[model samples]
Target: MLSSLLTKFLLLSCVNHCALAALNGHCPPLGPVLPAPTQPSKHGAVSAAATTLKGIINKTTAAYNSSAVAIGVKSIHESGFVFSYTYTPPDKDEIGTQAVDLDTVFRIGSVSKLFAPLALLKLGISLDEPITKYVPELRALKSQAREDSPVWAVEWDDVTLGSLASHMSGIPSDLITDMAPLGNLSAYGYPAANSSELLSCSGFFGTPSCNRTAFFANFGKRPPAQVPFSAQTVYSNVAFAILSFAVETIAKQPFADYVGKEIWKRTNMARTFATQPNASLAFIPVDDIWWPADLGFEGPGGGYFSTINDLHRLGDAILKHKLLSPVRTRKWMKPVTSTSSTGVLIGQPWEILRAENVTSDGRMIELYTKRGEIISYYSTFALIPDYDLVITILVAGPGTPGEVTGASMDLMMSQVVKTLLPAVEKAGKTEAKAAYAGIYVDQRTNSTITLFLDDKDDDDNDGPGFSISRYVIRGVDVPTTDPGGTTLPASAPPALDPPMRYRLYPASATTMTRTSGSGLEQGLQQRQQISWRAVGTRSRGADEVAARDAQFAWPMYSCVTWATMDRVTFGFGARDHFVFNLEDGGRAMAVEAVGYKVRMERMSPS
Candidate 1:
């Protein structure tokens, strides 16, 4: 009997368009809907995949001629799913190359931008507040500007902490060019070192020679990239520097000290520091021209060094919402402004990328990501909220030609996300099947339905939802019953015919009270109510579908399923909705087909 049931499931598509009318005649309740969790599993398969992926990474890192690379992957929902890979160049050097590992620290460069906003968020500082309120030096700079200065002069009073963090402050990208290579001034057309047209903080070595006093003294004279509050996302290292100063002033502690106590310490990122750590523990690339130099005021912008293990901890902390309240974290993760590209968005310090075709159903996934580079080092990390996944890549060596380091980072990101997202989706489906795939029956009404997740390798077998393997209503096989557009009453009968297909997608889940029984039985019985959207397919052949599509010039004509997906409504609620009463561990005890006005209890385990 079990083998026969399995064979029936294998042969079926789902419920067809004809069966939908029988199931969706009434209305379903309108309750809150939430995103389904991507239940990541702690399975050996992922680890084995990672092991294979690491080999590809090793070849790519070596091909880029990187001195060393460290990468880490963590699953937020699943314990024992941490993965790390390290690669060191085969060539030896006179400076003595130390073998790098997960614990060996590397300069994370501009990735430090992440900490400034996090610290301010922790302090309960209003992001909309003008930055000048805390960084009075900015106010001084605005006041000192000439009355006849260009219209692009930054309006410090109008710039807010939010704007700075989101790279919309319209400030200059750099305050000093000390990092720029020194060259003959006369050959480039005439600026002597003493000329006021040139910044006094010139020359390499002692060049960033500009202290806080000299930095602010000469900063006012520099022209702004755009007027304050302009709809421009200018990548400004100086903006983060100014934001750090504001943070320090408000927290009444140095920026580094504040973050150390509030962020790094709390997140257990022990190896992550605002300044370069001890050389013995760090992988300082051998580069005389752009060696590890103190960023001075810009330390908060791009000076932190961290190990792979610390980054994993930080990512885990952010995903688990251990660093901020759930509400605030959600707010923080969203885009502050949209960019010119449809697939790109700008958040506080995030470069949000909208990835497509990562799943079998072609759903878009938004990745909250950050990239950093400083001379010889490169770093990037992407946090995928949909999959509860985090991936970090750090590279250090002499800068490679053709920007190979960047290409290597992109390769790692695209490949890992492509591989892991589907794995995570499959894992979530596996978990869902165990919890929800079963027979539900209303014995009194003689209605029964069998639901199961399609684990078939062929994507064309069904839609990206739970398949209705078997469905019957009032002793009538609904899938096989062809009403031929005739509205049959709940108690009416229709002869069984050819079968059709249907699938159910999750809509919402909420806790509600059962007001049925009395006393203890009705004591505010809390059960999770989950609504599913039932969708049915037309039994059309591929040749007919192709002919119909060829006639319509518009592409949406071929994709009108979404038009009636959740829009249809009846007297009580949404049509084709099923509300499942869930127990702990997300197990469904019973289900109610609201549109059908029928409640069914879960059948006993097979």
Candidate 2:
């Protein structure tokens, strides 16, 4: 009897998305779709717990979206526990609290990209594989380009799967050029009709006038020998769609069905779908025909949908090597390009971010995470190898700021892991850190900074090991002392207190002389000395001493020195110095500094 109910539910799900056939009202064949397993009697308890957690997330989302039309949350565990919560405004006349089941499907937007890369990997396609192997028409397009034709002059044959996946292919961000023409194109629909229509009409890529197919075909017809690639990362939605088409061609199956069978079904994901037939299933209602109709089936980028519970199952499958082998999974999680260079890698459409997790015990764990957002939906999943925990969240509605959502979710999961891992480790469990350690450049300044903890010793005298130290800023080491007056370890100074030392050595400041002496043979060398002064100030709670040290010895080295009674904060360039405020128990709350024209803002605790 339970199996019958499970089968009925799965049938309903497939009916919700499968295209209707001509003569019969019956649902399409469940070729790739997998039915949800019958729920064991024990699942009731897990469902109850999930429902409670979903309530918390819904309330939080409601509080964040005070002005938004509606909000909801769906949470799931890999064990098949599912929960969902919905909130409607009291004063506004929107839809009421209709609980959208976790199994209900919605357009996952960019999250669909995760499957694209997986499909490529599953087919044993390397990142370096030439795209033309799957899309032979590109050759014809490349051959037609003329030296004078601006669009046709470039050769795209050399572009590989890796380049497209990483957004290094130099594809235009948009295809439409004129707003007037776009008005007509707007009525076309999604996975937009043809390459020409997409290139000439779609907004996903920056080009406004060229269709994706035409763009590729033109490249084949008149290939330019060389085209300069962008130095910075360019996020292209069309590129992923094209890649998806390639996947379909290579797999010789409908892209969505192929993914469902090879990836989702293989991993036992019963609730995931690429598209939904029922518009009401959406947490936030959307026009199913928003984009060109022909493009609707494109699955190279964002398009898959699944509940939070199913996502957790997917995450578990990924970590457990149930989907791709461990080696392939590692490659997917690895940083393909510096974050600064490319806002983030174009992984299957999922944006990958590398983060550092600092444990309370002073150990730093590195994490690689993927986040997806589409219209009114947001999803984030992170696998922390060091703690052996997979955290996933899916939110529905237009509420919290995207940045805040990601940061808050990450913080919450990090805290949960921090609390749970110690006990797990005590039980003789081993944890592994993620392998995404490296230096990343900040987009603004392009300054590269390390991001992982370095512990390897390079006795061979070569460059330091890439994995040695996780990201740590030098010149600010905090010493941890153990009992018996021994130092436990050194780490980056906490931002809790103001800096204690401030030194400003003028460009002209120089050391005077150097003297080396043993008992018998001593040598003294005269050195040039630049005039300097040392100032020390101590905070006396309300009052402090401002003293100048004139008799301080000057060394041949160039330096400036200043001391404060409390702690002194240093600002770059021409900034003033200030002190930190103490909290209730005389503990410092934050570091404060004042400059001549700049005021220090308190940084939030990470």
* Number of the top lDDT candidate: 1
TM-score of 2: 0.49
lDDT of each: 0.68, 0.42
Per-prediction TM-score, please? Answer: 0.77, 0.49
Whole-structure CA lDDT of model 1? 0.68
Model 2: CA > 4 A from native: 1-59, 64-97, 142-154, 174-230, 285-298, 341-350, 361-365, 398-606
Please, what are the lDDT tens digits per residue for candidate 2 over residues 479-544?
111111113324632452322221111111122344456555465432232221112211211101
Q: Who wins the TM-score comparison?
A: 1
Please report the TM-score between candidate 1 and the true structure.
0.77
Cα RMSD of all models vs. native, in order, equals: 8.5, 23.9
